[model samples]
Target: MSVDVTWLGHSTVTVDVRDTTGDTGGDPAGRLRIVTDPVLRAGLAHLRRRPRTPDPSASAGCDLALVSHLHHDHLDLPSLRRLRPAVLVTPPGASDWVRWRLRLPATRVLEVAVGGTAELELAGGAVRVSALPAHHAGHRTGSGLSRAPRDARAVEHLVRVPGAFPARAETDLLLWAVGDTGEFEASDAVLDAAGRAPDVALVPVGGWGHTLGPHHLDPRQAAELVARVRPVHSVPVHWGTLHPVALSRTMGDRFVDPGPRFVEHARRLGVPGAVHLPVGGRLTLDGTGQGTR
Candidate 1:
């Protein structure tokens, strides 16, 4: 019935879903918590978290954790160890990478391919997580020189909470996480996979450096994707969080401008649902399908 979205910084987000209908007989276990692409550290390689570091307990008690790709920033092992979610989902061939780092049981790690779906049954209801295509390169890399085997892949995710209400329009809460990617012709397949527009879309608008490559979306391109998905609420992420330590003095603007620029572009495109959350800010969606800050 109600959903809370917390942006910890960069691609990391926490989605908490509550059953406002009181159908769980007052059981607290009725709620579901999901985390995505958690990077909960002070610094990573040449990048340092701007503004401040994320709280160490930010990933505590997550039910499901989703990794979009094998990239270091997205599939951070230290963060995953802190999270220790009940179930961990990753793009194809990533489960092995996760196992190599963490000692999680094979049953706890799942590899999902594009268009594949996984279901989590909770005390209150059920959640469906579907993997969607992403246009970014799949292999893990460091400094653009060293690379991992080209077996891993990147993917977007669609999380749907069903049985919210009796009405068809309000029966489900659809949250789409468009992981790191570039614009592509098949991007429209997201609509077909979701079957309808999502209630909230987590869109990435920038990267950790001064220049963005063709593999990632810039603010303007992110705004365009927001217009196409047309979710009831859109949260701009993957920016204003991390930047190269050496460029901190000279490229401060790059660290803080993408989220606001995405908001501005979305406004110009007549998509006012875009919400620019500061790192650690939260957005709540009430039972009536309205999003409030």
Candidate 2:
């Protein structure tokens, strides 16, 4: 089996799973495509795309999309509209916000809590996605305190209700996309939930501002995270991609340095499989669990 990951920019990535074993007798080209935290527009919110990165629209046509949180950049409505993934996964209590924001009447939204799993079967293979604990706040603008009573009540009830997930099923690929979070102490909880370290970890190493915010991981923290979880291969996301256009002239290297810095830090921390994927770059994992750029 092999999984291919394309880092579009920032937290957006396209993960394609293929059955390379030859035993499944599936279409060699048939793969389940999943995009995480997709932001498929040139400019989103206050930040503008960095020059020279691939077009953000390259993330379109995903089999599914996972929104880790409600942050503007992560759950971009315009971007989501472009992809129109068949299934959309969000954290608990977020369906109302997503629906209201996107007006996605036909799209199916799956509300998953920490440890919940959602499985999707596609043409050539199947994928199992687990919602692990992210050490971050879940608030989004125009949500919660700002929503009217009806919507607020719905969100509260959905959040309080327990998450329902399927029994852990066998899958061709298993990925843990740690959306946007700092290092956490509840790693055991994550392991217990997934039952194993992810085959590949798409971790956030930087953000739009000069200073990292609460619950966001900088390059060093991202390296430490890889050391702890020890995925077969880890790729840095949420860095060297989007930045405030006005600051680009003044802060030349700041927007494009974290990914390389993270590669060095992961090596220093003894994470044997840290891979730095530049914008539009791709990484592939093979049957023996080795990764190639």
Candidate 3:
């Protein structure tokens, strides 16, 4: 179980997981690539990506892409097109929006409900991703109101395709990617679905705005989440990346402040380990799976 996790920017993370044990199903070169909430484009409308952020192409080549909600930053169409994950997982209602409105025709978008599992059989072994319930609002179009495309059958041709992952090698990596969820109910659903704690928990500690609004977690609340779920290792995300184009000068530091604040809270709470990665920082866990800070 060797896992390499890199925070590309914002909620986007690239996890390269490999199994070192003999149980690699006879394939040793297998790698499971998982990415979450990819907002790869350098600019989003009026909101410009700050300095030192990875380019859109940095998110390319993932076996599976997970979307926690339908917000513009989290589910950007152009970003997804650039990343081109073999399999895309979203909340139950978002698949249609992504398929037609977002214009993703070829990608296999599987809308998974809370407690439902999207199982992937790789050359190494099986990878199970459970879509846990999220507390945030799922509907966010440029206009507040936008209906699904009239032709439901337009995307019927690309429903399920096998052979997404390459033939490779073994070990298990359970990742609970909780994106921008503020409520405990969402976490409880994740815990209920995950029989054991996740190897790494990618939690959102803050957003770009000066204020932390409803269905969002600030540094302290996010610390509470880490204390409750208690994963082997926790990485703070959704901060230090995108910012509103017209924020007040006084609150500008909010963008770069949350990650370290969350780490401090996690320490005070006595959590196992906290990897407060910079915008492009990375962390690795070897086969032994020790929580090294």
Candidate 4:
């Protein structure tokens, strides 16, 4: 059993797994497809395509699409509306909005809370997903900066409420956890729930703005995160997709080096099994209980 991951640049990866042991239809090809934080646009705002285009969507029909958080980049409604996968998973309490955004039925949605797990049967294979905690915030707001102590709450990254998900669900079994945070305040709890290591950790490394703060990780910090979660392998995303066009004109080609820098840092830190795939790559996975280690 083996898992192939195609880097879709800027953190989106297609995790293709083939479990030879499972009976996933007569064709083995159908059991492969994991779409993570997909941003398929050739250009967004000022950021242009840095890598190749993804394997044609028809050819890469998705089995499972993972949305690790609620940030705009990861939980993009525009991108989500494009794929017609067998199942879609997201953080707990986010099914409503996701369903609304795509006008999808509750039957196809799975919300996973941190520490929760759900089994899914798709394309003749059974897969499991568990919600792990992220320390970052998922503030859809990207305008205006507030530094006043009273206005500090304006950061708008984390949103916690009593079961305040986008909408309600009826009987979706697989829990699609939207791990929408990456802050230290809840990191311990997240660490406890996901165990000593994560099967697949989709972390954020860049921000919509120029600086890193209470919301997301920079290149160096992302490298450290890799050391922390220690998943089997990783693919970078969330940068270079929506950088300010004016910002690039000022910095030249070096403007979009953060993702590449992260790859370097992972290598420098001896990130065993880590692979940096260019955008639009394809992967197949075999979740036969053999972890990335």
TM-score for candidate 3: 0.82
Q: Candidate 2, 271: how far from true, in Å?
A: 1.2
State the local distance difference test value for candidate 3. 0.68
Give all TM-scores, in the order shown.
Answer: 0.91, 0.83, 0.82, 0.69
Tens digits of per-residue lDDT, candidate 2, 100-141, equal 767776347776655566565644335555666767776776
The residue pairs that clash in candidate 1, if any, are none
Each prediction's whole-model lDDT (CA): 0.82, 0.68, 0.68, 0.52
Write the residue-wise lDDT of candidate 1 on 1-293 in tens digits: 67788899999998877766668554332477789998888887767877677775555667888899988788887788887888889888778667766888887888888889988764335778899999998778762353344778899999888755334456788888988999998775768888888888999999888788888999999999888878888999988888787677777688778999999999999997899999889898777677788
Clashing pairs in 2: 10-238
Best by TM-score, which number? 1
Task: Please tell me which model should have the higher lDDT, number 2 or number 4.
Answer: 2
Q: What are the per-residue Cα lDDT tens digits for candidate 3 across 1-293? A: 56678898888988766555446453222456778888876777656677565755455557778877767778777788877777787766668777776566644777766556666664334566666666776666553355633221100000111222123122345576777767655455555565556668888898877677887888889888888878778899988777777653545778677888998999999996777998777787766565433
Which stretch of 10 consecutive residues in model 1 shows the poorest summed lDDT? 141-150
Between candidates 1 and 4, the one scoring higher on TM-score is 1
Which ten contiguous residues of candidate 4 have the minimum total lDDT?
152-161
